[model samples]
Target: MSLQYFAGAACRALTARKDGPSLYEVCDPILRQPGSGGDPHLSKFYRTALGNPALRTLLRRAGLPELNDPARLNALRQALVLARDNPTPDWESVGGPIAELVDGITLQHPAPPRRTGAVAMPPAAEIDRVIRACGADLLGSYGRNGFIPTYAAFNLIGDPDIRGREVLMALQGLDARGYKNSTLMFNLARVFIARSPAAAVINPPWRGIAEPMWEPVQIRHRSAYYDAFFTEALLSYLETGLASSEQTGTARAAIAAMVDFCLETSREEVRGADGKSYHVVTALAPPPHPRFSRFFTQIKQDLGFGVYVPDCDTTACSFSAATQAGSNDPILDQPLVDFYAGYQVRAGGNEPRVTVPINDNIDYEGGVATWIDSMAGERPYGNDLDPTLNLDVLEVSFRNLTRWQILETEARLAFIRRIVGFQQRLVLSGAFADPRAHIYYLPELYCAYFGRCYHAFMALPPAARQAIDPGGAFELIRLRVLAYVEDELVGREMNPFDAALALIALGHLGGNEASFAPAVHCIVTAFGEGGRRHPYRAYEWNKMKTPTRILVGGPEVTSAFVLMGLALARRCR
Candidate 1:
């Protein structure tokens, strides 16, 4: 009758299924600790007595063979016999040891070997206990801070924008010398496919003029978060070909330069119909400028971290917008008003910083456009684009809230649209259909986009919005999830080889004809193992040694996203 009991009962009812017990069953044992319960009858059993000297003597006197060795099967039998009687208080020493021994033996002894045919599924109760324990252990490990081994190097670089400049500079120099940041180079290849602009500039990383001053720059490290969104986006791009736009002169040249860079970087050279590789040696060396102590002093004063050689603190882009909200609004948005008022005026002189988190090497140009559009009316930096519009006196309020779910969703959708636009255009054209390209790009694209989408999707009501090509999304995304496992087990970039996983997620996870399409033929052909060949062993071979040897402190908080993706696929199916 109690509320607590009622809630528990209700949860069980909601989750129950004919297949077996719910995840809750496996989760409970891990949540509760041993020896926390009061009732002995309800407690877990343990063996202790057969090994106890006093108990063994008592058992011997009671005509039971004294088996002192803990591992011996005969020793355990003697202990169990004495415990069954639950002997009197004068027999305390004997009874105690006997009870303990019985419990110990029960736990230590292995169960009979299972038959081969469709091995019985574990009991719901037992399964729940083990799963919960593993989950708890995983959670604990995940919380440990992971070291940004490469982050220190970036911090040594100076500011976010400076770091970006440095990377671009490094790429140019390295290419001239025939070298490159393998990670950066790898990502750029995908970008070339995803956003085929006429000309694109890899801007210096942009550092936001704000507090907490975290870096918003995209990273290539594959974590749960990156796997969810970036993987999928990349996969989609590969399958669909590349995005094309109106600009084709300088813009096209710039993109062509990137494509050339990618081809040069890959082992198998990628060339157009002419069979000519584009090559350019535009390079810029670092200036022999004096150390800007001012940059360090101000950043430390405002953000609290001393700027190392490479500054890792950078914002991907800035957001500025104006909107109206609230009843007595003066045309400007109210939510933005309340948010700024509380954070800026009431708390201190601080305003909420808007940031875009990317984990891929983004074209500085594309990011600029995205940043501008997303924040067109949000009033990000106090500068009013339209003086006629006043944020403080707005009638309709603009809510400036940073929700993980929203960001995740937005990123995923944007990635999807970008992929669809690019892929559809190419397919309609007469370009050669390349399955290798499809498998390589699709998973990475989805991994990145899905994380962002799921981050938002989970917070919304169940019916709020459906996934892209619902069935396809699920199967494709699931394949992306499997790629996470594969990557973790390996240590090299193997995009094209692992793309089948993405297709599987879309087809299986979506679970309906709504997601079914002849286009699936495209997916199957692209990633099917025997069909399209790719470099895979390099990374997979590394997985075995990477975790133990790497300086990484631990897994990151974002890894849960990957687990969430897998769970969604499993449960959705």
Candidate 2:
């Protein structure tokens, strides 16, 4: 499960406060309980690395205090809290002393300085120039790697949420050449082509002994899920004639790879209700996280070693892009709508088994399930459901169905109602801080996608819009997210990525040009001001278990999102 207990040791080793994720946010272990049969492997050490005597002995020998040293941990935690409240121009380092756990892995630039202040918004013409420049940034974001690459700090803590555990790669973002050239692979397979990471990553400050996840080689992983979203964004801008013919051609070819991946990786004979079977797209090709073998990820999907299964989020994104590109339209081949519809949890028999606290009050009668595989190889698989996945499925399904002129269908209504129910019980409830919200995303991102779909639907004729969202449910959610975006604009400290998401959500559904100015003013202050585009991490870690979990994204996707927000915001006012 979660080796979160190790956060203390990691923090202590890094000479960080015995509290917080200064090193790595209490890490989830990398080791899997390997086997094909029933749940195996016990031992407190497997559950929490601190329980291992050998590891504990190392900590003790290294003169590290008890990991459960409550008083000291809380003191350190409070110190960090105080430091954050009093951030300086350059975020002053709070680290105590470096603990050299691994030789040759000495680090620097792991923690980025806090970005504050505001930048003047450019004039309309200048904004256009800025947008074009941002577009260049977006295009330049794609490296020799053919797609956006995700960076995990060499420290095992996957997400590295800097709020508590801050570290930024020194050679982050694009090099002097105007594209990211540095990537550190934990896997032996050098799938991505980039420069080796400098000795300079601020490794979780090591003041004492710390254990690292001893993961083996990883396989070739082209993140088709991420590519689908980026390709769709590129495809949209391609119509503006912004790219050179050669760049356009290159863009088209990359789009082809994503389409091919989605089509080829689609799992066949996936069972629906009553012995019905259908072809379906899964999140990953074979292993969701190529850091592990197919055997490992397969078992992990079954909660064998990981938290996420082949879920509907990847399916929605991949299928939506493919549909937009006119690649593979398999909706007609199988009972596509019917297959997805059957997965919807009903009030009683079909209702999702409410496992998460967020959905505890909401009856999951019409909600969509996240994981798609109903069964695999004589074993029951697939039951991780969430409300955001419903929004994703609903919007994509509506858009794709409308595209094919298959608007009037029971399944369409089901998808629409699912998010309606979600908005009522979840968003309106202001329980937005639900722990599960960040399971797969930083909460604000859900708003961006929700607004994206709403924007598309609103652009249609009034009659079409009415027919699509007659209940005005989607409108309510849109307003809720829009209001949230407007509200976030005034916050003291804003995550640049969250601000980018806010700009996106606000841009899609129009309020006023005035509302957009503030966040944009704040965001650009951190956007490549003095020189190169620094990597402002989005803090995306599944924070769940599985073979190996690494938070994805670097400056490429961040720049792409900011650029998209800026470009789309132009249509406002």
Candidate 3:
């Protein structure tokens, strides 16, 4: 975790000298020979040396030149090259130079914008076209699996603060046509209740499934975390919406039944450090068969019973058996904490709050291994799961709770602060600095930045906002975002979904309305006229060629994000 090593490694990874191989290549040969583990030092470098905060402290102590100074940066790079080649280098001797290098490589803040331009609204006609296209897509894509439909429904129905009548009607039509029973359907019902209780009361969808939805069903373990939160959200919404005496008693009973079922079925008991037993909810209950019993036992032994389920397909199971436990990974635990925090807020009662077990040995090295192992399809790993995407869902839940005033002010502020910290660390880590490392994740990243993180920051109080971004980090982020959109999105053939995401991010970043006109025009043109099916493509990144076409998900997903982009554009306007 030493900052010096982190800075050196980062600089080495980022730079390629004209004279020879990169400093990274010199120090860690395994990066060049990807499949081989010839050097132990190489294996440990990524986890231990990169992104260490201690390096920053050492740089400040050494009184180095500012990060933007070209001379200082060049000198540090040369020193790094020397250090990489020295077999028995004295780190103490190189410490001063390394500090200077570290200082030179840190992310520099951009100057504040000279003009914070007035909001430039997108044209109403264009907005109508995109909205109509999205609505049609949602109708065509109903009953599909994955959260895309749920997301589409929610976006179309609009947020509590932003209402779109046409979108709402599209969703109501789906309901009228009798959408099948699924976790997402229930989740959407909750959203409806939260946004408009009167409408929800009159809605056939909510009324139809209001009682029977509480029954237990086997949900895939991966989806369980979100399903749980949505269920709780529904209950919370029901409590508030049914405040009037006419429907209070029956609604409260149904809500009570649902909560009890969730607790009883999902809870698992584990002993704490104090030798006291506590119950925590598992995302999904393992099947009661001898074949899976042994696997379940292993998950319970290593990371406790409920943090994350280790059971996967046969290939993954074999990998899990050979590798160390992935449950100890912090990324896994953080999301669990996020879900529980929201659940606690939603399920306000005398029930004791669940605390995550702290494993002091969980370090950067372990996280990297876990991530590598998971990505290689050898073991269950949560680190590879983008927190930005996961947090987007949680952020939506949190925002709705806060808006409804269900979450206490202090708790809401605390959650907002945590989210702000997460976003700051993500940006500073330079995770997206490498195009190859983040190409596939660009759309999700954009959605998270604009749809969740930016909104959360804006919701913070003045003092809190200043504390998080005192040095114009937002301005720098905005600049980086603009560069990415122009380089990766504009004039290049990309999926409508990704294009829509870039548009939303641009709107949120406060780019000129006219600049987005071309993109908007592209979307409308691709949407075409009449009932022709908008082509659906899966999301994948091609290193050899830039994507000029959409991948993955149907028109439903594309239209949902398009509508979302338009909604955001309206706000910015």
- Clash count list over all predictions: 124, 23, 9
| Predicted structure with the largest TM-score when compared to the true one | 2
Single out the weakest 10-residue window by summed lDDT for candidate 1: 310-319
Report the error of model 3 at residue 33, Å: 32
Of the two candidates 2 and 3, the one with more favorable lDDT, higher being better, is: 2
Instruction: Write down the RMSD of candidate 3 (Cα, Å).
Output: 21.8
**Predicted candidate 1 versus true structure: per-residue lDDT over 94-167, tens digit per residue:** 22333332222111111112112222222334322322322333333323322111110111111111123333
Local distance difference test values of all predictions, in order? 0.23, 0.47, 0.34
Expressed as tens digits, the lDDT of each residue in 1-573 for candidate 3 is 235644554454234222222223222332222223222232233223221343322211222224236665455444333333444434333334432222222121111122223333346676665665454344334223322221101111211211122122222222111111111122222222222222222121211000111111111122223233223322333322323353345334433433433344434454332344434434344554112335434533322122233211111111111111112222222222232232221123322111111111111110111111111232221222232332343344333443324234555445444443444444556444332222123433443344434655566567655754566665566566666665545434444455566676776666655656555655565565223554322222111001011112233334555665655555555
lDDT of 2 by residue, 1-573 (tens): 125634554444334223222121211222223223312222111333223343333222222232246664454334333322332212123221111111112222122234345545556565455455555665665545555544332233223222111111211211111000111111100100001111112122321111111222122244557667777767755755666787788668777766766656544347776567666666555554233446534533332223223556767777777877877555434434566676676666664433322234344567666665535532122244566666667666665665545357765555556556765567776644343343345456667777777766676678766665677876677677777666543333455555667678887867556667655665555555314553332333222211113445545565566666766766663
Query: Candidate order by TM-score, highest to lowest?
Result: 2, 3, 1
After TM-score superposition, the amount by which residue 144's alpha carbon in candidate 2 deviates from its true location, in angstroms, is 1.4
Which residue segments of model 3 deviate by more than 4 Å?
Answer: 1-123, 139-379, 382-430, 433-440, 447-451, 467-472, 528-554, 570-573
Candidate 3, lDDT over the whole model: 0.34
Residue 111, candidate 2: Cα error in Å is: 19
Cα lDDT, model 1, residue 365:
13
